[model samples]
Target: MSMNVQNCPRCGKLFVKGFAETCPACVKDIEAQYVACADYLRQNRKCDLQELHEETEVPMRQIIRFIREGRISIADSPNLTYPCEVCGNPIREHTMCDSCRQRLVRDVNQMMDEGKNNANAEKDAHHFRITDRLKDRH
Candidate 1:
């Protein structure tokens, strides 16, 4: 018998076995989320499904199903505020799409790198003073 190798759809890891779609890492992550959700419910007694989804990194739909199945309790209060899906930043008025958030993060990181390089060059040139007392000494 011959086994076929396929790349996992989730993590892109190559596997030669059953036709599981996701990679081992992604499977482990899902299991971890299940355990974490269970643990959170047990410890906290009750929590909003949205909050558990955010904290455990689980999907809201899955959490809702878990609640329906008695795996977790649904709080009577309003749903928890989840961060923007893209940048993990708190979303206020407008919904920030994932693509936009990722782009913003990339841009911010690039800007930060540029600023760091500029600061290093300035430091090498002694453009900034560290101590006010040393100004007269130089």
Candidate 2:
């Protein structure tokens, strides 16, 4: 029931925001490109990004997007790799390498632990000054 108006990234047309990003026309075009890329990959399992882009005529950005979105995978092509978002190491899957992922997990866990400790400390310093006053009066 809620409507949001935003400019489409593909054609720059203002449109009611929907599940998919691009407007209807652009969606069709992107779908066509995805199909073409998928077909090309099926035939050429060992292809790299450059060769895939050259052969399929799909943009490298879109191809990378497909990998990020999990629509495409590079397991069969061992040489294929994408830069990690954190350390820029070459990674075959996900945005980060294993070390970066583990580090992030540890950092987040430490933050959560600190938050819980703070909350517990606050609870213990604790309170009920008004309750004590009422009890004394009674």
Candidate 3:
């Protein structure tokens, strides 16, 4: 059997036989990560989870959990903007936050209404044509 030895730097605990360098009870690494994330956010102002993950090598799920748990705040990014959900336009504050979406919805609704009206008019015209042809034959 091979013997493994390690030392915990924080608690001065001696680990042996397939144990971690840091003791399981010590939370130094977790505290350091929190401090790093906070510092990076304070310096950068605002960043997406993906950007922060790439820059700090933090896991995306952890970052999101941190944000949801009020450990980090997501603000409007001055340097970068996310795309609108509907039109793919860059928005600073919200997703699909643009006048274009409203306009497009209005235009689509109007076109649909016009199409319905035209169909009704066509049906009426067809009825008239059939009636006239029958009268002429009679």
For all candidates in order, the CA lDDT equals 0.65, 0.86, 0.66
Predicted candidate 3 versus true structure: per-residue lDDT over 14-80, tens digit per residue: 7662444466655556556667777787877667655777888866555554555666656634544
Instruction: Judge candidate 3 against the unseen true structure and give its global Cα lDDT, from 0 to 1.
Output: 0.66
- Give per-residue CA lDDT, model 1, range 1-138, as digits (tens): 776888877667897646455777777886787799888766665556566777888887665445555555444323433345567664332346567767888999999999999999989788656676588798
Q: What is the TM-score of each candidate against the true structure?
A: 0.41, 0.67, 0.39
RMSD of each: 13.0, 5.6, 13.2
For model 3, state the Cα shift of residue 128 in Å: 3.7
Residue pairs in candidate 1 whose N, alpha carbon or C atoms collide under 3 angstroms: none
**lDDT of each residue in 51-93, candidate 2, tens digit only:** 8889989998888888898888787776667678899887888
Return whichever of 2 and 3 wins on lDDT. 2
Clashes of each: 0, 0, 0
Q: Rank the candidates by TM-score, best first.
A: 2, 1, 3
Identify the candidate with maximal TM-score: 2
